[model samples]
Target chain A: MFDFNIVTQWLDTLLMSFLPAWATVLIECVLVALAIITLYAVFAIVMIYMERKVCAWFQCRLGPDRVGPWGLLQVFCDVLKMMTKEIVNFRKTDQLLHRAAPFLVVTASMVTFSCLPWNKGAQIIDFNVGVFFFLAISSIGVVGILLAGWSANNKYSLIGAMRSGAQIISYELSIGMIMLAMICLTGTMSFSEICQQQENLGWNIIRGHVPAVLCFILYLIAGNAECNRGPFDMPEAESELTAGYHTEYSGMDFGYYYLAEYMNLFICAGIAATIFLGGWAAPLIPDWEMWNEIMLYVPGFVWFLMKVFFVLMLLLWERWTFPRLRIDQLLNLEWKYMLPMTMALLVVMAICVSFGFIWN
Target chain B: MENKSYFSGLFSGIKSLCTGLKVTGRELFTKKVTERYPENRKNNTVSERFRGVLAMPHNENNEHKCVGCGICEMNCPNGTIKVESEMVEVDGKKKKQLVRYIYDHGSCIYCMLCTRSCPHGAITFQPEFESAVFSREALVKQLNKPGSKCAEKPAPARPAVAPKPATTADVTTPVAPAAPESDDKVAKLVAAAKKAADNAAAAKVAAEEAAAKAAAAPEDADLKAAADEAAAKAAKLAIVADNVAKKVAEAQA
Candidate 1:
């Protein structure tokens, strides 16, 4: 009932009736790009507000409640304030790279977010190597950080950028390994195909069982570490690095960086939801026919959002609960602990996939 | 031994992480302790002894205990208190009468020395704290309300018995023999406040009439100018009225 493809198809026909095919295609591209940007910005705003509220709740305090009702408009006011602030730059800074850094970061996040399968046939880009594309695109954010830090000619920014570069590079291995473990079980790199397989197979987590759950946990850790969130947030360690790689940035430039960070969190949560927790697949009982029928009545997009927010909550929970890990401990955890665990889990996943020991 | 310790350490570390999660998770649903200031201002309580600002206790009759002793002014370390007193003839006797009790809240350190050292106990700290203002001049307050009399007669101008206990029954005596020029100034301020308010009301009515005229003659430049002029006059008069009303309140307070 909530299939978005039908609406898109109707619009497609209406546009085709009036416009040339090339123009129609160009306009559709622009529309999708605009939609993706809007989604990215909206998710950033929601996630930031959610993070604050969740953090406040965790600490046994009322968060922002003075701006609007329950302080819902606080973020909008914050955005306005940030947008109007004077953009300051150091005279010695590399003007071009410094200017381009925030945009690059935002673009990287925006590109990765567009590939997410929100519902049945609602993906903007159905890339053949969808999982790999997300992995590759997400890493470009660190490059932006490095550019911002190096361009600023500030010691703290440079150190922060270097640390982030190191942290993301190391964690990327664990993320890739964990995804590989899932890939072994699901037998597809395309996100939609993986999700579709989860429909009948009763979610890769239940199908692959032990190894899948291990991969899920490990993937969350890797995702949190990669996002530079707390516990693994050695790069933007405010106690030491002030504001880290974007220390020199101000006004909307700094705002873009902030937006990109939260967007990255959402992207990570979305990926985890799609891969491990059954993207838009509703949870069903094995023997209850009536229950299965009831589950099918709810829309897939809502299920997708539920799973994504659940994962997002877990990420934020981990962030606020744990203290920041030292840089040494961060790399040590990745190389020593997370890496070995994923490798062993990958082998176990391969055995499960080969033996047909998964649920159907 | 090393492998056993390593594996045990891993399990323990995982357990501790879970314990931390459980702690924070439990806290998530617990009662929040935020004060929600501004929203809960009525229920919010400051300590009774909280030295917010100094204020003179004027009785229901608008009479204060300060007999222009100036001891509170001398005890103020920051010179925050400036007690202006003048000689006045009451019952054909010259007595020191308080004209103004200027208290600079911005400079006051809240030391309470002025409140404590007052022999007559004329002033004390009030708990009314939300005293923020835009300008520094607003922080400097005239504590004694305008035209308020001393609670008692000046004790027959006895210099030796300056710390005599105030008698409320003595309020039947003649109040401050206010100088003629000071009385004229107060009258002038009250007149100005009334005049400004009337001018604002007149300008508003004129603007409304001009707006109606402009509506009738859409293409008339002169009519529009008249309307704009009337609106401007109303706006200026409204501001003047606001200032004068504030001055009137200050005078009365």
Candidate 2:
């Protein structure tokens, strides 16, 4: 981002000199939004490729190898294929919502990125109620999924959307609880502030002890559930729902659901890194100035990516390894098991925070 | 149910999931079951008993064991095999020889009926199952060479019965005459037949005398004498054939 930083600074100075301040800010905001969209597309492609390779390895099979080396270009080729395919609509459907559903889903997922902390000062916006906004905006994607299913007038899609709505709403409780646990530990809602606080302390996982680790585990399961992936992927259960909400979708509309799904997974993993695993923060060896200085040679963005990839690997590992949980089982697990467990962990964590046991 | 508490049940569920994950994690190191087909074709070998296409077993001399008996063709349920034979001159004698052995591979359902029904152990199932063809015509193959005849021939025992002509006549007479005719016609027929019979008898007696003489004579001279006697016998048979033809013509008139 050297040139990107330089070019953006140059544009800002140029705009400030010539254009009205409001117009300059407005155009700059649009450019940043556009950049976020591009990031979503690129991140979706990378995650999809990684998923294919990792899932293949888990099953003792070779993944795509025909395109670029180790099939790195497979996603690009798939994108081309999806773009060229005709978007087929069904006989009886609400054309407006059916067509609008995917973009809505994608936008909901993309908006959450404005509050994400990639590195120190690398966030798009530092909202005072950032964590709340993240939770609220991300959950809005369920509406898109519901509309996708309901608008298509497909029974399977309707069931899928309904499941997605239920699953996301249920899992949202546990995910928010885990975030609250982290928030309690960090004492901030802004992503960069939370991350900076983690840098001050070691990490929430270390300071909050066992409860923090439990919170991490609970978050992993619920976040995966929220994204509607394997194991927790009952809504899009291919055997059950065909494609869940996106069954009637074709061509790029179908592609959009996939993009949103995988990109959502990426953010979930990124957030996990940010909250529990200490996003972009290397472990500190205190009183060793030489080693610390050498460690600084590694960029924070790379550390962020490495942590994200680790989380992704965990997601992939769990997906390939486990059979899908039944609908009743999924609800029961969340309501009966994860909900109570996460709530208990949060109370434990709150005690730890109050007693000054968690390092500031 | 074990009546387990919520915490205990949750722990057990996660434990089971972890166990399954462990299995897949171990499998991550295992070799894959799929072989890229076209690239790995050279490494493939079908089993010995694999029934692919019908073929005839040929010796090192390029001579196949199929005798054009049409037994395989008859036994084929789908009419896939077609055997056609025609009379051909071989070794100066007219013999029924194999003209074509058309095998329609497209119609063959890989039923080993044709291979099993062959009496001479002639048909075999060649294990070459990459048998896709561009056109149906490409699958219809001729399995034998042109004018291919059976290797085994039976021709030498006709004269051995001359010593027991009474029995031989009983077996041979009715085979030629289908009706009772007028006395003159019967006499002519008998005369013509008797002349033919006398010629065969004389030839037999001469053959026996020549055999005895050859046994007593020197080796080189005996072979020359045998060759001369064979020519004389062949000529006498030609004369008999002409007299029989005249007798048949007279009867028709």
- Cα-based TM-score, every candidate: 0.69, 0.72
* Number of the predicted model whose TM-score against the real structure is largest: 2
| CAPRI-style quality class for the chain A–B interface of candidate 2 | medium
TM-score of chain A of each: 0.97, 0.95
User: What local lDDT does model 1 show for residue B45?
Assistant: 86
Q: Tens-digit lDDT track for model 1 on A248-304?
A: 999999999899889889989999999998898788767889998889788888899
Q: Which whole-number lDDT from 0 to 100 does residue A181 have in model 1?
A: 88
CA error at residue A176 for candidate 1, angstroms: 0.5
Clashes of 1: 1
State residue A197's C-alpha deviation in candidate 2, in Å.
2.4
RMSD of each: 21.8, 16.1
DockQ of each: 0.61, 0.50
- Name model 1 segments beyond 4 Å from true: B1-4, B46-253
Candidate 2 docking DockQ: 0.50
